[model samples]
Target: MARKIPFFIQIILIPLLIAAILLVELKHPFPKFRLAALVLVFALIVDVAILARGKTRNLMVVLASLVFGLSLAEGAAGAITPRSVVKIDRGWSVRQPIMGWGPEKAGTYHAQMIDPSDNSIIYETNYTFDSDLLRHTVSADSGPAIVFFGDSFTFGDGVKNEETLPQDFADLTGGKQHVLNLALTGYSPQQFLHEMETSRFDKVIGPDPKLFVFLTAAWHAERTSCKAYWTAHAPLYALEDGRVVFKGDCNEGASLWWREWLGNSALYSYLIEPWRHKVKHNDVELYVSVLEAAVKMAKEKYGAPTIIPYLRMPKEYLQGTGFTNDSIMQRLSDSGAIVIDASLQKEEAAGAQISIRIDGHPTPYANRVRAAQIKAAIDEKLPGVLLADAK
Candidate 1:
């Protein structure tokens, strides 16, 4: 007679074996204890079947063990699949490639090159708008200053520190203004409003800033509704009493963190996004609402001059792309902010041109032109403030 299997072994083995299968899908690693457990369970099942004289039971046991074992091993391998980790700084974590604008104009291949402008190389502030910074930028600040807000274009994606629009403004004005570029990459207007309310730039400088300059590109209004934009880019939140609460996961690489680093391959987007809007919600309306709210908040709560500089593209260039609508322009005008349409105005006959050859962002030369535009607007809209500061 074959040896009898222990009752305890059967109970433990059955559940563990089942669990192992489930864990395989999760791709969790297996420790040595699990391997030994599997071996013992298989041996016990075979022995028990033989002792009971269960015909073909041994075959069944052997097949089950082999299948389960292979699955577990595969899961273990997946679990061990290397993950790239980025160290996050105080009050925020910027997951590169996670929530960023899809790859460059050319395209990415098997070798996914991180955008040179991304923070993976340089630890810039808005590269990844983590929870801490997001919370603080909108919160109350103490002093008078200039708060500059918007998406990547305002965040200085391709440009360096001193070359950003805000920096250019500060430099041109002789640094009299405390200019904070609160813009974040892949930022929706809602996110910008959140940053405005939560992060208190005023505290660092003074009370409500003298001016609130918001720079916007045409595409930001549409891309705001993207699910990948929401998931990978948005701040963290947890369910609290059936309500969502911002937990602000400041830790770099927590096990609970669930974010995809390698999103849709760039090649896929090049082929797809241009053809399809690929958004779940009405981003245009949402963008309009956010802008309206921002204007209201800045005027009523902060008492600052608000400016929305519109980066206009030629109709020919925007033909294939879906950004040709005048809705955003209408919204900017309706919001009561100064609208500086760069493309509409002929390049200043006197000054150097700042247009980018390959991309939409303004070049260093272009930033100077933008600075001139802002100065011109300030002179017209807030002449008293400009004159007082000049003195």
Candidate 2:
């Protein structure tokens, strides 16, 4: 007792179902399971269309079966996948006028970090930020404080509070020195200069810092110009007439609807980020200029000896690429900043197993190793800056 459905309706349904499956495949985070489900769904839909034999009742049953199957598949996927929880304590960060975003809240952020390579759960940890949005102390209240500024490496991305470079340095010095960490995750040379210009380093830290250190990696150069996930919401800068110039904010005049929908997708980011970096390849000059500006500010305002420590790329990745950190280091050295080449240290670290397997950030051992190298370099190069028995 069922009416026959038209052939045209079945034809339309087939293409629509395939298109729907394709869209899901593109957006789904779990590709393996999603692809399997897609294939199954496609096969089922085709079989249902053929078996329906133009019966309306069969078509309705097919629709119901498809809906039920998809719901079950989604539920299964959800049950197996671990959820990522990120809690940002009050006063952690606020939107800035030109910088787009900065740390404003002074509390701890707890989250389960996931490895992007395999989508595996890495670890759950807490990240604490001070009133100035700094992970370390605002200033050395007692004794001469050493200040460090840079991106996530300096921010101690994968490590705990005590495992950071500054903390290790403080511990190595027997806790006699104050180590100020002004580093922000995803910071470029531009943000470092901007923070120096705006932050209350003198009032908060009190007295002049004995040393100022700037840490960077080759990837940071691309961050200066690319609108990737890390730098997309940050302030833009350009080098004009041999001076650092603020261009504007990246999130300015953008619609939140599209950003919230597409920008949050990891797949979207994975695809678009590389394209953005490729298009904005001429950022080397901007990076160099920003470094010069930071060193100039440190020397002029704080009279602190500036040390720029850069992480070396892996030898395998460095091959066939014209990219080198030497030119940047040389430029910073020319501007009176002592450069610490971490290439040799990186090789040594490989032998020591000092980095995480899933997440490639430096481990606690690696941080300690870097700290030791930095202390040695300071003792050898700057002489009286560090204590004689600090190591």
Candidate 3:
């Protein structure tokens, strides 16, 4: 009976073992760690069912015990994890098949980030969007437009209407520039590319857009790759024969089942999620390729110079990638983009501050500083527009 038990156990485990083996190989571009990971998984699966030695099944028993123990740990971690309370009124933003999450509807909605431990409100602010679903522009009907593209930093995550970067830029330029801020929270370069490809600009953007600017950050590299958990629905692009081409949504990868499942494990959250979302380096070439396409389209479609900001990759994201941040900037320059300099990007840590102590987003003052730099860049490129052109 005891001998038969091992056989039956092996039979039951075989299918899962096979599935896990297959999953380990799915869409994993990082070849350096593949071998070690395969070895570890194989040993675990083998110990659980392959081994049927003499008296004591100590090693096998230990491995089986860990499987259950880790599961329990995962459940516990998930239970205790602090979840912020977020409340948004109706028609805030709609779901877009291409952009994953589309523009915010024109209305005022309030948001806050509360500390779950003490149930304290960290910060509270209201957001107002235009009929075109953009955040804020001095006057969308006025002057030559300067379009902005970026994530929360450019979107002014926690700031109010008058304090956003685009708003600040308009105020600084005497409201002469019709700043079209297309920035949104959780946006990646793929959204930018998709919007341009679909000609969303022709219908929505104000007439005669003078220049486009993309605010730089280290995380843009990861987000653009569509490997992040929030990006499953994002329009995915791949490099086909050295050209970046759209290949539908990222969810089309049936092989990426493992990332979806394993990513939910709170044990994985502690052991891997932080580095998983951002800690490890992802495919830079694919990301930069998408960005390259955006840059070209900006010029070809709008006939305007797109100024991209350049920031060094934080040292933590330096591992597991062949190219450096400088290489990313080089890719932009090679694509006919002239300037991605210090005037637009601030590497100084002190320059960025937490907004109202709510989160890591830039404060209103920080946005003002960044806006001044962008205005300076625009003045140099466009020249005559800054003659105190207040609307």
Better of 1 and 2 by TM-score: 2
Could you tell me how far off, in angstroms, the CA of residue 39 lies in candidate 3 after the best superposition? 31
Better of 2 and 3 by TM-score: 3
The CA root-mean-square deviation of candidate 1, after full C-alpha superposition on the true structure, stands at: 11.0
Per residue, candidate 1 scores C-alpha lDDT tens digits across 1-391 of 9886676776666566566545642453543333444454555465455444455776767765884674466446435533333332332323433233222322111211133334243222223232324212222223357677776567665555567777777776666555666675566555555555665444543564678888775555454443332344453333346333444431226422432321222322334435555332244455555676677777777787678887664465445444454756777678777777754255545554554433445676677677678878888877655425542
Candidate 3 regions off by >4 Å? 1-71, 85-87, 253-265, 278-282, 338-358, 385-391
Residue-level lDDT tens digits of model 2 in 291-314: 888899887877788888777665
Q: Write one digit per residue (lDDT tens) for candidate 3, span 334-379.
A: 9876555542244345555534564767778778877777777666
Q: In TM-score terms, which candidate is top?
A: 3
Per-prediction TM-score to the true structure, in the order listed = 0.55, 0.70, 0.74
Which runs in model 1 stand beyond 4 Å of their true positions?
1-143, 227-231, 235-281, 313-325, 348-360, 387-391
Candidate 2 Cα lDDT to native: 0.67
lDDT of each: 0.53, 0.67, 0.69
